[model samples]
Target: MNIYKQIKSEILNASHIVITSHKSPDGDSVGSSLGLQRFIEKLGKSAVICHPDIAPEFLFWLDTSQILLMTDQPQEVTAAFQKTDLIFCLDYNGTDRIGPDMQALLESATCKKIMIDHHLNPQDFPNLAVSDTSASSTAQLIVELIEQSGHENLLDEHIGTPLYLGILTDTGSFRFPSVLPRTHELLAKLLAAGVKHHLVHEVLNDNNTASRLRLQGYAMSQKLVIMEDYHVSIISLSKEELEQYDYQKGDTDGLANQALSIKGMKAAIVFTERDGMMKISFRSKGEENPVNVLAAEHFDGGGHANAAGGMSKLSVADTLDKIIDLVPKYFPAQ
Candidate 1:
């Protein structure tokens, strides 16, 4: 399939273009959208990158401050959606991933929609879809698309930096199981394209404030709970605790990973009290123990098998209790 060729043609034919991704925009979501935006701009077509929510603090250095934020500048972003001739949905499965408010605007859009995502079971909503679940991240797919589209020359530091950051972050700096041989090949190509790889890594991983570090340390020392029989470890933080530590949006980003690293641990969970809900993040060792199913069934959230997320309207304590009751049932003895 001439996938990139078709997408390039579609972009060229459109006058005004808009790009978007899921809510709580992660590295992959924000990176691929901005990378694609830069590539398209170099082709003499300017595209506005719109996101349903804000990117985490760690990703702020990506300099996407100029991008239209749906939260802060709703009218501008809404107008962009209305007037756009084409919209590229990057890193997420559907309009649902964009959240309810943005989903309404997206569904109302009469423009051609292109879905470029790496999530499983994408919804059939886009006019053109290049969904590949096996791919590590949407950033990887964007690289393949540009190369296959015969526009590899357009991938300079501007495009490569964000793309590389997405792959690095989404794959846990190439430590996750999703990092395949193809991922390395893409990294090599990106490096050759002059992406500041080490600098990007330093910026992504090392740019943490003292408060964020203290918050992480507190969560690890005071809040962790381990279930020996179920091989699960959980950490729950109340809003009071978050406020005590001056919590920010990205503060708990990798807290679940610390729990998952314990000996004999197969499942790790983090629940943070946020806006009258307990926001949950789940991670497991392998797909053999799919967490998304457990999340969807119990927590009203879902994602990849090994890395899923959910939410609970219950108070933080009750939410933690409910999860403890469930861990034994779903994650039975191996």
Candidate 2:
């Protein structure tokens, strides 16, 4: 059987199906999970969305109550994993991306596993996978999967909206190089299915809180630093700073990308200090530099060529120093 048939078979054979994504759920993660879960439900199986952590407030438009966060309900999520017979892992390439607790639980699961993701160098896990690094987002892959499974009619506004969110954000609003003609074709189908593209954009991008705006200003004014000689821009936010501004999960979503908006900048890294560690977002100019390799080799993180994420056990200051020290090696000053 083909890929669609295999996934459909898993859905039809299972009683309790658990859908999940990586930790720190983004548009692609949350949207793909919700979108795929709804589709799976249409197939007559009971489905649940489980994550290792919570999604950001910007995604509040989604009825996220359907999503069970391990951070908020650890036992309940563990119970969901316990009873799952078929697991659909969306948006993340590896189980490791979902945090240690979830990773261990996922590894111990006797259920069949399927991975749907659009990230580079997927690890050797999962019983089956639909891994395509060139795809705009896993949401795009979800759309294709739905259509290929002969359920294109289910791409109604309810499903179309979240799918649109995943595609819209993951492709950087269609500006990223991953956006292809086929991507547009899928988007056209979504629009035809009654997805208000403008509102989708507005809800995800423009739906910011006043505190978040103030926080952005403060980060830009106080924390942002430009290294002219190295063509790098860096931003660091401590947990203390985040609390002072009433930090939300999604507040720093696009901060690293915004850093790269500076002229002549070749790379950007946002170092957010949290839980006694540093959470880093890395972005690089795709012209020559590949942040995925850089992050993987140096920062203990990986994603796409231009955009990736990593973590550091060192202090925030040291993490910043280490990243700054490595920039010249990747893009040496000539």
Candidate 3:
């Protein structure tokens, strides 16, 4: 499908546009949304980037303070949605990730809906969907879209920085298995477009607060449970512990990678209890196990093979027990 043509046609004709990403906004979601917003602005169109939750502080370095943070259906956002001629959903394919109110707005809006994502198993909701799971990040896909749409010259410093940030974080600083030669090539282009690499690096790596560090120490020292026999590692953090540590969202970044540090570990799981639900994150080293498929089939979540996530309605203890009971089935001793 000619994704570039479709996107260009929609943008050229539409006046009011709303761009959104998934809940618990991550680097890729914010980066892609902000980058796309700037790109649309360059085309002489006004666009609003909205997310259901506030992003990590480090992400603010992307200069997304101007972007709208929609915790609920605000009157301004709702008004924009009502009059929007087009809506672009980035990073996530399904509206389930964008939360209920935004999902309802998109479903009910008369606007032309477009999806630009890099996740597996996309839903058939958008009028034009561009989903390539092989892409390292949705920002990378947006870069390709801009190039194909003949908007390469429109990518100024503002657009370049966020796209670079998205690509960098999503690929784990270009250390993940998804990093391709083309990914580097795109990074080089973004750099040429005046993206500040050092700023982005600092934002992603050096901005961890003291509270987050303390929380990490607690998680690693007390919460981590390693089951070498099962090649499974589990880390569970309760709301009480988080409150004690004064933890904020994104404070637990890379907490799951601590399990991968153990030798012979096949899979690592991190469970964070919040608002009565267990938020689970799964990580794997090699292709020995398919974490994303496991998350989708067994858990109510899906992502890439090496890293995926799911949430359980069960309590943290029950969720851990369920994962423990299921791990042996997937990783049995030969």
Candidate 4:
């Protein structure tokens, strides 16, 4: 169904629109939401972003005042769903990704739902879905929507910045295999639209706090365990360890990738105790060495082949042991 054309049509016809993403708002989630909002404004309409939770502190620089967090204001979020005529689900495929509260509101709403994402196995909830696993990010799809829907003339710095940020982060700063020539071509357009690429990199990367560095150091030096036999690295941090560093969300954002950088390491798994449960993040290199298998089958989560997320109700030590025990079965020694 001409995805670009239909989405444009829906936006033009709808009076009130609400945008949504997954619970844990990452760069892709925030960027896609903001980028699409700007695009809708360019179309002479408006949208309010309703996320299940707040974004990490690192992304607070973007203009996110329009976002209504369900964690902060559930009544307002419910009202938005009740009044909106259209909904745009970005980044994630399933309603389950937006947490139980937002999921129920989305399910009960009779609004026309449109999903634009770059993930595996999109759900059948949306009236229109644009799921392209190969697209670097959902933000990239926002740009595609603009260009393909005959709205390329509307893309400017305000719109391009967030879309560029989404592609940059989701592609691991252009290092991930998902990036292709088309991705770079879109990047060039963003740059030409005055996105100031270097400024974005500096803002995103150079804002790390000292406490974050200290926590990462402690994790890498003390908690890290390398299983040379299976070529996997594991880092598990208990709630106490996190508190010792005055931990904030996203403090361990790249810890798994750092562990995976070790020589001969096929995959890296990090477990952090937060919110009374163990949150798991998996990172790996190469398609043949997917971490999503373990994330989905064992960890109660799933995502892209190279990166995925899951959670464990088990204690940190037990969760670490469980992952170690499962490594042999899913990623046997080479």
TM-score, one value per model = 0.98, 0.96, 0.96, 0.99
Clashing residue pairs, backbone N/CA/C < 3 A, model 1: none
Clashing pairs counted in every model: 0, 0, 0, 0
Assess each prediction's global lDDT (C-alpha) against the native.
Answer: 0.89, 0.87, 0.85, 0.93
Candidate with the greatest TM-score versus the true structure: 4
Candidate 4: list runs displaced more than 4 Å: none
Ranking by lDDT: 4, 1, 2, 3
TM-score for model 2? 0.96
* Model 2 bad stretches (over 4 Å): none
Between the candidate structures 1 and 3, which one is better when assessed by lDDT?
Answer: 1
Residue 317 in model 2: lDDT: 80
Candidate no. 1 TM-score? 0.98
lDDT of candidate 4 over 16-70, digit per residue (tens): 9999999989999999899999999989999999999988999988876678999
Model 2, residue 148: what's the lDDT? 85
Candidate 3 lDDT, 1-334, residue by residue in tens: 4779779889989988999899888889998998888888888888988787789777776776777766753666777788889999999988889888777777898778999999888999999989998899999998998888888888778888889988988887888788999898888889888988998887688887889999999888988888778788899988898999997888987888877778888788998988788888999877877788778877899999989999888877888888888887877754
Clashing pairs in 4: none
The count of backbone overlaps in candidate 3 is: 0
| Candidate 2 local Cα displacement, residue 2, angstroms | 2.3
